[model samples]
Every structure is written in C-alpha cells, then in structure tokens.
Target: MREFSEAYLERTREGMWDDSRQALAPLALDSRERVLDVGCGTGELSRVLVAESAGEVVGCDADRELLEFAGEHVPVIAGDALRLPFPDDSFDLVVCQALLINLPDPAAALAEFARVSTDLVAAVEPDNGAVEVDSSVPTEERLESRARRAYLEGIGTDVTLGADAREAFSEAGLDVLETRRYDHERTIEPPYGEAALTIAQRKATGAGLADDRETMLEGAMDDEEYDALRSEWRAMGRDVIEQMEDRRYRRSEEIPFFVTVGRVNGPQ
Candidate 1:
C-alpha cells in the first residue's frame, strides 16, 4: 500500500463530508453494535461514523503517526488492512474511505474486512481518473488532466477502483447490497483564504509539482513528455500565483465518490 503524509491527507479531505450524508445511507449504520474504520487516516470517516451511529466506533490504521492524530477525535488502534488485528466476526460493520484505491490488491483487503464483519462491509472510494477541474485559466484544465493521468498511472493501483467495488465485493464472496454516488465539489473563488494561498504558493515555488514528479513518471509519461509537462506545469503555477495576487483566480474541482455496501456471510 502507498503511504500518505498527514498534510496530503488533510488537504484532500478538507471540506469533505460537510455537503451531505445521503451517500452514507447504504451502510445501515443506525443499529450497528460495533463499527471499525480501516485505513482511518486521521479519523476523517471515523468521526462521521460515530456521529451517524451510536455504536462503539474504532479507527484503525497502519500509520502510528496518523493514529496519534486521530486518537484525539476517535478511539484508534494500530492495524493493517490486509491482516486486521482482531479475530473473525469482530464487528457489525466494517468500512473504509479512500482506502482501497491505495491498495495494490483491494479484493484481498475486502476479504479481510469480510472476516471481521458479520453484517455489512462498505467502501467509499474516488474515481481519480474522472476528476474534473474548471479553472479561470483554461490551460489549467488540460494541464491538470495530463498531470493527473500521469500521476494516476504511476500510482500502480486502481485509481478508478471506486467504480469497480461491486466486482471486488463479489470476488470476496460477499453479497452486494447497495451503491450510491456522491460528488464532492470544491470551489475557489474571490476572497481566497489561507488554504488557497498555501496551494498557490506551492505551485509558484514549483515545490508541489516537483514533489510528485517521480511518481507521475511511473509508466504514465515518457521522459520527453514529462520534461515538457513539468516546464508547463511550473509556468501555470506562476500564473496561478499571479492571478491569486490580483484576486481574480477562480477554480472548481469535482471528485466523484462511490459508496458500495455488501453483506457478510451469515448472521452474527
């Protein structure tokens, strides 16, 4: 599995879950006795699970540092997704958000979830390949697409796994229950705040793009295209910074997430 930094997790999850909860209904979480959140990075979903259900919610992750960060908000345990620490039938519901996509073999992890869950298993994942960006600077759209494509390819996991979780559930010998779509739209308009400025600053310094340069090259782009893309990427970043300074830059991103729920083998 790919490791994530605290900063990356925070940035990606910012403003998430604030829009709506309709997508979470499939989990049937109201009466759950025990709920476990796998790959609960900083407890983003754990807090939601606790708020939505009155069960004993536990957040588990492989990262100790993240567990510490999450412990403040929810009960956390150090655990791996592929080999969960608890015994069989440990909880009534087992769920994860943006976890399977990072896994090389998501089906294997789902099987683990099945082992621990007696009632339901759920996965919330994003279709990174289908991400849409609308920026005031039109070139930003195309460049972002190109950069995202390469970055996704190099990630070596099913970045589009959100759309395929049903098949994975079947592969794991689980019965499919329900699926829902949730579109998270983030807009950056006038009166740009600190988050916008921080992001723009990273782009302006070329530090942001440079950080992911190696990963973006992983089987996605050849050396020639990458060199040109990097050059243009930095140039676009400078433009973004300039636009931000003038308070005229505006951008919108839509990330599509699928909530897939499945049933465990037998009664608890």
Candidate 2:
C-alpha cells in the first residue's frame, strides 16, 4: 500500500464532501448500527460518517501516526485492511474512502470487509484517469494531463478503480447493490490562500513533479522525456504564479469518484 503524509491527504481531500453528499445515500448511514472506516487516514471521511450516521463510527488504519489524528475525532485502532482486528459481523457497514485504489488486491480487502460487515460494504474511489483540469494558464492543462497519464501508468495499484469496483464486490462474494458518481471539484482563483500559494510554489520549483519522478520513470516515460516534462511543468508553474499575482489565475480540477455499495449475504 502507498503511504501518504497527513498534509498530503489533507490537501488532496480538502472539501471533498462539502459540495454534495447525495452519492452516499446507498450506504444508508442513518440506520446503521455500527460503521467501520478502514484506512481512515486523518479521519476526513470518518467524521462525515459520524455526522451522517447516528451509530458509532470507528476508524482503523495501519499508520499509527495517522491514527493519532483520527483518534481525536472518533474511536480509532491500528489495524491492517486485509486483516481487521474485529471478528465476523462486527459492523453493520464497512466502508473506505480512497483506500482500495492504493491496494494491489482490492478484492482481497473487500473480502475482508465483507467478513466484518453483516450488512453493507462501500468504497469511495476516484477515477484518476478521468480527471479533468481547466486552467487559465494555457500550457497547464496539457502538462497536467501528460504528467497524470505517466503517473497512472507507473502506479502499481488501480488508481482508476472508480465505477468498476462492482467486479471486486462479486469476487468478494457480495451482491452488487449500486454505484453512484460524485464529482469532487477543487478550484483555485483570486485571493489565493496559503495552501494554494504553497502549491503554486511547488509547481514553480518542479517539486510536485519531482515527488513523482520515480513513478513516472517506471512507466514508458524515459529520463529524457521526464526531464523535458518537468521543464515544461516548471515553466507552466511560473505562468500560474504570474497570473495569480495579477489576480487573473483560475483553475479547476474535477475528479470523478464512484461510491460503490454492495450487500453481503445476498438479501435478508
């Protein structure tokens, strides 16, 4: 599994559920008795689960450090996704957000979730391949799409597992219920905040691309190709900063997420 910094998770997941939570309807949270959020890093979704469900929401993660932050919101425990700490039928609903995409064997993890959940299993995953970016900087969109393709090709796990998660549910012996699409859009415009400024800085320095250098190289992209891409990325970043300074920069990234819900033990 890929490990992520709390800051990274926070930045990526910011305002994810703020837009519209209608996609979460299939989980039927209001009547849930017990809910377990696996890979509940920093408790972003865990807090939402707590808010939507009257039942107790427990967070479980393999990262002890992350668990510390999550523990602040709801009950947390250090546990692996493939091997949960609780026994069978421990939770009425078992769910994960952006977790399955990082796992090499998502079906195996779903199987484990099925073991613990007597009722439903759900996953909120993004289709990174389908990410759409619109930016005021002319080259920014092209460069971002280029970089994203390489990263997706190089990444070991299925980062684009979005709506196709139904296959995994079947493999885990769960009956497919429904899948809902949720568009999580992040935008940057005038009055740039600290986070936005920091991200722009990273772009100017090519630090963002540098972070994924190894992964991009693992794909069909060679060193020379990566170097050229990074150069263009940095140049685009400078343009973004200039536009921001003039209060003319505007960017929006729309990531499509699929909320796949499945039922265990067929129907009651």
Q: Which candidate is the best by TM-score?
A: 2
lDDT of 2 by residue, 1-268 (tens): 8999998998899999897899999999999999999999999999999999989999999999999999999999999999999998999999999999999999999999999999999999999999999999999999999999999989999999999999998999989899999999999988999889999999999999999999998999999999999999999999999999999999999999999999898422
Per-model CA lDDT versus the true structure: 0.88, 0.94
Worst 10 residues of 2 by lDDT: 259-268
Clashing pairs in 2: none
Instruction: Give lDDT for model 1.
Output: 0.88
What local lDDT does model 2 show for residue 153?
86
The C-alpha stretches of model 2 lying farther than 4 A from their native spots are 266-268
TM-score of each: 0.96, 0.98
Clashes of each: 0, 0
TM-score of 2: 0.98
